[model samples]
Target chain A: MKHNPYAALPATVENIIVETSNITTFTFRPEEPIPFKAGQFVELSIPGFGEAPFTPSSSPAVNDVMDITIMRVGAVTERIHALSKGDTVGIRGPLGQPYPLDKFKGKEILIVGGGVGLAPLRALFFALAEEMDHYKKIILRYGARSPGDIVYRNDVATAWGKPKVDLMLSVDKGDEGWKGNIGVVTTILEKNKLSINIQNSVAVVCGPPIMMKFATIKLLERGYAPENIYLSMEKNMSCGIGKCGHCRIGPYYACKDGPVFTYDRIKDEPRIWD
Target chain B: MAKQLKQGCTINGVIEFLTTGCRVYALSQTDSNYHLTSDEKWESDRHMLGPHRPVEPLKSILFPPRQGVGRLLEDAPHSSPKPAAVIGVKNCDLASLKIHDYVFRDTEPKDPYYIDLRNNTLIISCDCSRPCDVCFCTAVGDQPFPESGFDINISPLPNNQYVLESGSEKGKKALDSCSDLLEEASQDAMKARDTARKAVYKTVEEQAAVKGLDGNKNYQNAVTGSIESHLWERFAEDCVECGACNFVCCTCHCFLLADGRSATGTSERVKQWDSCLYKNFARVAGGANPRKYRAERLYNRFDKKFNFFKKVLNIYACDGCGRCIEACTGKIDIRDVLKEALDEA
Candidate 1:
């Protein structure tokens, strides 16, 4: 009998964190720890509902438990929002290419995340933080629709906003009580006047298609090379092992070749933003 | 080894002889087209088992439309079909097995079910002596004759005789089983088979030329360059999205997996055929759809067959079987579309 790649490992919801009105973070303890690099994703399934691919938001260094931040969207995510602690779900991956942390060892690493796009970046952030002395510098520029929509509030305010890392947060329209930057995340890069050493730096971007498009243009204008920009692409990933052919971008199978790809690699791919 | 089935032996007699050791499926005439039928429908002289491809592709027999996969309940037993012989398979249909091999067997983590069916089924391919109006096998780097990928290929000759050529060890074994009904191919029979093959190739070439499809155009390059062509929208406007084209296609193998729970709480995962034409094929979370337009979906089907499969598998997915043209509800001919796209490119 051939090995069925669709089989899911049973996992129990260990904890739940409500990040916003529409978004929640579920921490699961599987029967076994799913070892994966920072940007890889897993196909999470609630038995009655269906499966969807998600990147773990927690550090890859953490064993036994994984954190998946999900925004309530469509059927599967809506069902996931109704799930509580101790609920049983299925997980099938840790598939796709991960962030090339080895390449950024001696270079400055800049991450730009918009909305829940920060989920994967949070994992990369912690993974990089573990090897703090290896990289030159680490920076994050994150944005959300509003002050209420920010994810990982406690972690961003306490753990991730340390002196060793430069953390910049922004909202499209800030509330009256908000005291942080009041424009898009790209604007924070300009307003803060952060000295980004483009020659020796690499930028990882993940967000809405429009945000990523504009952010990429901004990065290119700032003298960052095209090959140095990494993108976390989100397509309709059915089988996380690349057999389904749903997540194809030109000649690349996004599930296997990448959910993570350098900008130069995919510049010629058609309808990438779409 | 080459052999000859005697002129007096009826098609039903040969089928009966073959079926004594294995189940046999052959073409039986339906109201509109020919379908693969077993002993109950097989007739000696009633059915015309030659000259055209069948309505249902050979892929349906190998990789079924739907099958239960993964763990099953103790009460439910999955029994694979016994070893069988498939006769009257056209050369165009046989060509697609090469692509299916690349997909289901040669790929990593090979599909055991497909491999099992492939191992058990004996393919008896038939050469197309009379090309159909829509047939264009020559246009896609193939002739209306089987070169390989079959256990036995039957080239028809005059006076009810057939030139049988064994292509594999299984074929030679099957031929050896029925050695009493066969004889060594005479020089006259050999010349007749060669003449028949050349005649069929000429007719297929003539039909393709008359349809303006006989050209050395690079379909992969044409489809790659025609991604932005407006012709796709024009052609796709009439599409009803019934997905008959994909269903009838021999190479389209996209599938969807779903879990069905029984009354006893045992869950079974079932694999079902899926089509790219479906609106939700490319829809992701948060209501984002990449190929939302009907034109884009239509273009994707051709693009996958000509461009993507060629780039990945080193073979174009389409073998010019023309089943898609015959099965289309909107009468959208792939040949015309391909020709127009190549011309524009």
Candidate 2:
């Protein structure tokens, strides 16, 4: 029913929590709680500045407060880094159609994320973790360029230590103290033998496009159906609604129609591997 | 009542009749091209509604290129101005505007800025007596003559009086306001208006007779086998990726919502147009562009037009509006490219 694409209501910047050297978790309290599904993102606006789409790193269950982990890469993010705890910002969305969570129920779910792409998937991880009894298996394979690039390291590590989640952390290159998996994330998927069955499971992946492209092929090799493989897309979105055609991949608006789509849905689109 | 205007008739009289003090827009020629200009300057009797295909669209006045979104700014407080009569909008532009409305003002609303502008504007469509070579509305189920969606439509008659027809409440209001300009209806006046309008339609139809894709059915599946064709590479090579095609395109509405930081300590989120043809349009956080090659970008552009838009909106992305063909610096005709792709496939 809500139609305005650029309507980012005023939100208060609760605090700026540091995640990695480049990435930080921005906590904000909106005028009203923007309750959204785990995989959905909001267009965060810095009034007089600009807006960018971000998924809340915090759990969707915690409605009162929200956290968006941002990697300072562009102008809007640079301004976001300079803002203080009490600064005022704006937010529109919980936009785009969220991931089809109900369909994933009772299936073995695999979450593979790379670097800052884990921010959006983090919400999914927490949402699934909240209702751990519903799904059969929750396997999270998270990787970064290096140990420092990893986000939510402590929380994810602590979650990995738990019996409910089978969480694995890997880095492309690891230091002496890293002692964890040292290789590409796809290698971990290939080497490790788990109870991952493709027929009844959906693999949700978000990361660099090359990583996703290769990771998708790897998942397909492991018997994951093309339709069963869900991909959270990151494109050039200006209006988090269908109005601005910038984020359109084929006919689908990355903002309104999807930031999340199945492998079969977008497999035909050219240059998705880049 | 719609009526035709004479060669020597003053446009001010038409404006006075169209708007009893309400704002009205008219097409005037500037630098030899017809633009959707207002009444401040209407010197030449030679140009009526200019010619056709203005430098910009009537949509620009209704929906400006850039405006603030999200929370409204104090200094630039967002105001939906009262609907003014937009006169002399050609049929091609009108058809393109329909597509824009479908994207921005459909069942799912887009920007409130667009809605406000659209809500306030009264469209007065005119029949293009002279359509250009690139005009192809007839192929896309639209004629050069005004169809539905106008508040009021006009047809120029041989006599000094113009035949006016009301299409909506706004049209009736405008006519009622200008009652002093009206005369009793006569059979000869009606016949003259119809005759002139028919002649304009015939001229436009003859000029726009090009082979167009079928309107009722979807041609997306027909394009599936053409993906691997070398035509994509050939077209990509010529494309400088300057983004003129996408920017000038009526249906290419890609935009980026940027948060602007003013030196005045005010932060604003402004939504500006963007193009997928750009290198970094699809680059994510880790600096990876999915559409790395120009070939892929070109394919994506055509795919959006031929394949994607049809899949979602049940309408082919391209409406046979030839703005992209005319605007491209590479001189790439999408129609020819699409035809080649289909043929080679």
Relative to the true structure, how large is the alpha-carbon lDDT of every model?
0.83, 0.72
Model 2, span B1-345: residue lDDT tens: 454344455445755556544465777666756766654333335335544666565656655666665443333455556656677777666766666787777747555677777777777777666666676655445666676677777655554456666678877787666656554446787787668767766665565445444333334654666788888888888888888887666666666766666567666666666777888877764566767888878887877776766677666656555777777888887766766765766
Residue pairs of candidate 1 with colliding backbone atoms: none
Off by over 4 Å in 2: A1-4, A12-17, A82-84, B1-15, B30-32, B40-47, B70-76, B159-161, B176-227, B230-251, B261-265, B295-299, B316-327, B333-342
Please give the RMSD to the true structure for each candidate, in Å: 2.7, 3.8
Best by lDDT: 1
lDDT of 2 at B265: 60
lDDT of 1 by residue, B61-116 (tens): 88788876654212234466688878888887888898788767887656767787
DockQ of each: 0.40, 0.53
lDDT of 1 at B54: 80
